[model samples]
Target chain A: MAEIARLAGVDTSTVSRALAGSPRVTKETRALIDKIVHETGYVVNETARHLRGGRANQILVIVSDIAAPFYSDVVQGIVETLAERGINVLLGVTLRQAKREAQLAKQLLTGVVDGIITVTGSIPKPVLSMPGFERKVLAISRAVPHEGVTCVTIDNCAATRQVMQHLHQRGHRRIVYIGGPNYSETYRDRRGAYADFMRENGLAELARMRATDSFNDDADSGFHIMKSILNEGDRPTAVFCATDELAIGAMAAARQADQIIPRDISFFGFDDLKLTPLMSPPLSTVSVPRFEMGRRGAEALFRQVYKDAPSSSKVVLDHRLILRDSVATIV
Target chain B: MAEIARLAGVDTSTVSRALAGSPRVTKETRALIDKIVHETGYVVNETARHLRGGRANQILVIVSDIAAPFYSDVVQGIVETLAERGINVLLGVTLRQAKREAQLAKQLLTGVVDGIITVTGSIPKPVLSMPGFERKVLAISRAVPHEGVTCVTIDNCAATRQVMQHLHQRGHRRIVYIGGPNYSETYRDRRGAYADFMRENGLAELARMRATDSFNDDADSGFHIMKSILNEGDRPTAVFCATDELAIGAMAAARQADQIIPRDISFFGFDDLKLTPLMSPPLSTVSVPRFEMGRRGAEALFRQVYKDAPSSSKVVLDHRLILRDSVATIV
Candidate 1:
């Protein structure tokens, strides 16, 4: 490091900043440092630096499933946000498996990564017992029960209440709530809000709900669940799904049963997916700021990892109810 | 290691294998080794191992866009395949930006990862010149021009030919081709094949094509392009899109223009996305084994990385043209 600084006629700190791609160095000085480093082949030994207890410059972004449409934007946000800071992201998919989550948590605690940003909602229990884990963990989308980890999420209860109120205002007396797995805190909160609203509004008798099997909230699950509802001969005025995938699947099943959307049944979904607007009737959904959630989660994790910020902060972003053509104004 | 093995009354190699989660160790012995390690607070020194020029056991999976819908299944396959081997996956999204790809390539070459598997189609030039890069790089869905990296992709020419022939067999003369960005080798190959089939069938005059702008192949792009085509008063009997998103978008535009699917125009798309089956008319697309492509690509890279296998192999997987409600059998 001193040799590079002497050759570049700059302070060692400037050389270090330049090497780390810090913006503090001017463009000309950065060019000079790059030239010198290229000529001297002074490769930064990341493994050696990590052995010396320096930052690995990498963090693990763990998700339950990458193939889920909901996560792609969120993961993209984290990757892009962190890349700007010259920090690489290691993606670990748990597939909602306990063993896999435990394995990945071991890697995070064992120094393979600088910290962990879990979008999977729940952190492994064993990870909580690790020393200094509080300083290196952040949760997104779902709040962690532990006081050590910070969480970034939208107000699920508020979002659900808004959806239910909208349905009630539209004169949808019988609204069925099709929830995802109970393991997800987001789903639990939404379901809780739905129950609370129904009871408070004296519509408890019309409060019917069904949930997809654990770890299975995809469109197919929604299709089968909706099929069962249709077969039971109890038609609801509206269906509120925990996810857009579920709503889309329920819509498909309704179409198969010759039920016209909005005319026969209204539908509402969470997570305004990119393809939602392109749907036939343009799905009415709660537009949760997924990308912003990911970006803020990364930023929060960065603050905790580098700036010594408190790790127990909770950040609640804004969400909007997007009423598209899928919902009907019933009298 | 010696203490763990001595305490467990096992060989050091057994202890190492057990620690590495190798399947060769019996369940009883593995449990014993885990107990000893837990009691002794033993943690694997990944950094020290890498400093000794050992395997990092982590590979980078680079993609152009994570939200493209095309990549989620592929990435899932890669993650699952590697996780079974106790290897970790680090995801790097280049977002089709040249600088980001170059930066990620630098990380791969600088020993931060054991190897790299690029689904981005094009590998950075500097990475091609890196020593031993041949043994550490694999390409999926798109072939790298360099001879060093093995590639796993479907035969684009054959797939496109099948789509064109199927359209022709259905007595469609004016089948317009809707392609994606030209930067993608897969898109280029598909377009080239479409041209070849048109000329060979002596329908050159009927061969009209349109493409989305560079790095813009999402549904919105398809919608705008279709709208322009409609404005131009060029009504083709059918449209063959390079991706499912494009097809879905085009279909939406057609619906907006009050054109009934199949009855007014037929549509065909590549990459049978999960939501395709739920479309009102159900999209007819070519089924490219995306998960298999990812799985095979990772396995090929694993062979080169671990077994010193040759890295210049080309593995072409099969593709099927699915005929659903989107296409019409016109007389």
Candidate 2:
């Protein structure tokens, strides 16, 4: 550090600030220091720094599927929130698999990181219930049975009911519920809400399709399931999916089968993901506060880690229905 | 561990395996073991483990943007590849800021992890040129000037030429190139190729739209730029964007302007990111081997880290032009 400082004609602290990417130093000064360090082959010895500082200055953020746009927004929120506090982000993706989720949780529980924010529904229940784990954990957009862990989620039932009522008002007589596995709490709550909405409105909930992977991360299952519905059974006037991923698949299948969107059958999705608006006929879906959920999850986790506050609590954010070109008036 | 095992009537190895989420034991056994550990108030003291083990057992993955589908697929590949070797991933987002990239590289260069895989075009040159860093770093889908850094990139010139040839053959004479920044090597290469293709084919290259951010991580720039082109005079018959994100924006702008696609204008994009098919008119794009690039970068990093291989190399993957509804023959 002193050598680079001497070469750049700056103080050691300026070099340190530059090395840490602190905006305190000008870019030109940093570049000069960087050039000196590059030429000198100087390294910071991060292992020694880790030894001196116990916290790792980093957090592990576990997401269900990195490829899914739905989770990426929340991950974005988490990354931005943590970066503000100078804490780095470690990413663990489970592909919505319980084993992978459990493995990630166990590593963190065993102490690789002091804190974790998990956004997967399939995490092993035992990992969540581990003693001392709650103080260092946050659940985002998913429910964990353990009492001490903080969580930020939306009311799935209420959101589903709103979607259902809107579809009913649009004169959709028959609606199919395309969802993931019964094991997923995320899907379970929404499915239950749909059933309740159907019974209350006197609408028959006869058609339901589960995407091939009980978890629905596979993007093509929605299309395949919808195709079968159109081919084998009485067609529902509308279909509501548990996620935008499945609905995208369903919409593609409809397009391939020459079933015009809304004109032939209306489609609805949860999670108004980034690409939903760009769909040929824009998709009408429920918009969950995904980024807010992530930001709040990080905020809650930081409170426990930095301020030593009580960790066990919950915050349910709001959801809105975004009606676009996908749905239509059916006579 | 012994006390928990004895209390649960299981061997200490069972407790160890369960806590590590080995999956050798049944979930029921794991749950029982977890209950015993929770009741016994046992914590695995991760600090001691990290200190004793001497390595963080994780790799840092620096991405251009976490929310973009293109980078996410590559990251997913890297995470999966590393997990197979029992290594974890630490994610750093540059947001296309050179300062942020420098700081991330400086941190990793100093030794937070034994290795880092960076997927960004805006990384500072000094960080890559820093001695001893290349032995522990891999660059994915971006060209770096440092000879020591191993990289996996597609042949941008060849891919762009194919796109230009296809559009020219489709009877489009005036084509607009919607690109990122002149400073960005990724776009510079493709732009150079487009200029070459235009000159060789006796076509004029007049329209060039740089996305709102020269760094191009923000996905909405293409739409904003395309809208301006629509409002102005002498519209090109076709537009080719550097990324699917930009093409998506361009398509939306065209739709809003009541400009029918293919008939009025043709659109082409690079990167066959998932969700391209679901577009109103499925996008025609150049499919870069994003996941493969990520996997190869990790492979290169691990080879150098674990096997003590050489530090520098390059691998150019194939690119495929996918023709879809976005473009059409114009007489």
Candidate 3:
């Protein structure tokens, strides 16, 4: 180790940490040290190194789906922030399967990753209650209510209210909400708020659809749901989706129906993904700071990995409604 | 080892490999064994285990960008197939940075990853010449022409030809090609094919744009490129891009310019990403089997990992032209 330190121009501890593959050693230092180690034909026993250092400098991030751009920006933020801190990320996309989530949670015990940041919440409680879970897990986007568990999420109810208020002010009396699977806390936040707002405003919530498939982020599934809604007549004057994919799918259906947006009906969505801005009418949406949330969420995980702190606080970020051409202000 | 195998209901080699975290052991068997090990408080020294097995079931995949759905679907396919084989994946997103690519390639020498599947080319040759590079490296999408190297790609020339054929038959005499960075092999394949097709038909190949910010899959950048092309006064009758993201961006630009697609100008793109179908005009594109390609590429990697076979086979998949509302035949 001392010899490697001298050869690589890094300290002895950095040589050890780099050998351990811990996030504490930056990639450049690791590369320089690895190059020297290879030239000298030095072999590193990673497990032993990890055991001594107690960190592999690697963190695990579990998402519902990677193909969804909604999650991609979040991942982009996490990777960028972690990389700067000499931490590497190992990502898993659960595809909304609780079994897969459990399987990944099980893999956590192997200790290849020092900490975890999970965007999906269906992770079983038994898995979460395991001795090592509480200290290492940080939930983002989907809030987990296990006391002392740190969660970073935007104000779901507040954002939902803003969408409702926007549509209400536009004079749309019949409004329907398209939500995700009922299992998600984020869904609960949005759906409960949607229902409560409707009740308070004397408008009935008649058109809420869930579980055509568990896929909440895919446009393919979203298209099917929207097609069903449009096919069944007596359609609501306005529709608000839990996420952008649903709204985009609904828009495609509307176009197929030859109904002009803002002329025939109003539509709104959440997340405000990059593609939403490029949609034909430029979707009206509630914008969540995806990249910023990801950066902050990863930073929270690092606080645990670096300072060894056990933080179980709930952090609520802000959201705002972005009114675009999709919403029809009924005159 | 024999006793552990009997207890885990598997063979001795399976026990050894599972203990070593080798892809050879199925995840279920590994999980069952891990559970048993934890229940029995059995201590397996992972370093010694790896030394005995001589392999890690983990393979590394290097991608150009993780945020793009084009790459995500490819990753999804690779991960799903590899996981079925009890293999774990370590993914790296280069974000089109040459320095980052160099860093990851350097880490390959540390031998933590058993094999590599690089979705992007531009890997430095000096790094490829290092010992242990040949058998374990497989290039997907972007072709690497190093001798005795395996590459998995769809028929780029055929796909490009089909796009040209579609536009030509649709009465588009003036067509523009929106290509990726000139350094990309896939770009070369598609661009060369486009130019050759035009030359063969005696159509002027005067509308090729490259190196405007060097962005390959960003709509924001694509919008700027398209705006410039539209502002140049002699806009092509049709615009074909290397990827859907570019097409979507061009559409946004066209919208801002108050020019309707296919009415004012036709549009076409490649990859037929999921978002393409939901776009305003339902983007016309060439459909490449992204998920299947990913699966086959990973499977090719596993054959080498499991059998230690020095396979350098070039496998080309098929692509088809998808006609959508974005293209309008002149009356």
Residues A224-313, model 2: lDDT tens digits = 888887886688889999898888888888888888888998999999887788776788999988888888889889889877889767
Residue-wise C-alpha lDDT for candidate 3, range B1-331, written one tens digit per residue:
5666788888877876787799877789999888876676454443344444666566778887777788888888888888777666777777777777766664455555677888986554435766766678888887786776788899899889989998899898788887767777888888899888888888855646543466555787778789999888888888988888888988999988999887999999999898788888889999989899899999998988788777766989888888889998976
- Residue pairs that clash (backbone atoms under 3 angstroms), model 1: none
- Per-model TM-score of chain A alone? 0.90, 0.82, 0.84
Each candidate's TM vs. the true structure? 0.91, 0.84, 0.87
Q: Highest TM-score among the candidates is held by which one? A: 1
lDDT of 3 by residue, A1-331 (tens): 6788999887988898887799998889999999998787665555445556666667778887777787878887888788778676777777667777766664455555677788886455435655656667888898776766788889999999888988999998788777777777888888889888888888755535444366454666667777787888887788888889888887788888888886887889899988788888899999999888889999988987678777868888889888899888887
- Which of candidates 1 and 2 is the stronger one according to lDDT? 1
Instruction: Give the number of the best model, judged by lDDT.
Output: 1
Q: Write candidate 1's Cα lDDT for B160-239 as tens digits.
A: 99999999999888888999988789999999999999999999999988999877999999998888887888699899
Give Cα distance to truth, residue B98, candidate 1, Å.
0.7
Instruction: Give the native contact fraction of candidate 1.
Output: 0.73
DockQ scores of all models, one per candidate? 0.69, 0.42, 0.42
Stretch of 10 with least lDDT, candidate 2 chain B: B209-218
- Model 2 — TM-score against the truth? 0.84
What is candidate 3's CAPRI-style docking category based on DockQ?
acceptable
Task: State the weakest 10-residue window (summed lDDT) of model 3 chain B.
Answer: B43-52
How far in Å is the alpha carbon of A288 misplaced in model 1? 1.0
On residues B1-331, what C-alpha lDDT tens digit does candidate 2 reach at each position?
7788898889988988899999799999999999987777587755455555666677888886788888888998899888888887888887777777777765566556667887775445545565577777788888766667788899999999899999988898889888877776788888888887877777745635454564553446788889898888788899998888888888888988888887899999999877777676788999988888888888888888878899767888888999899998987
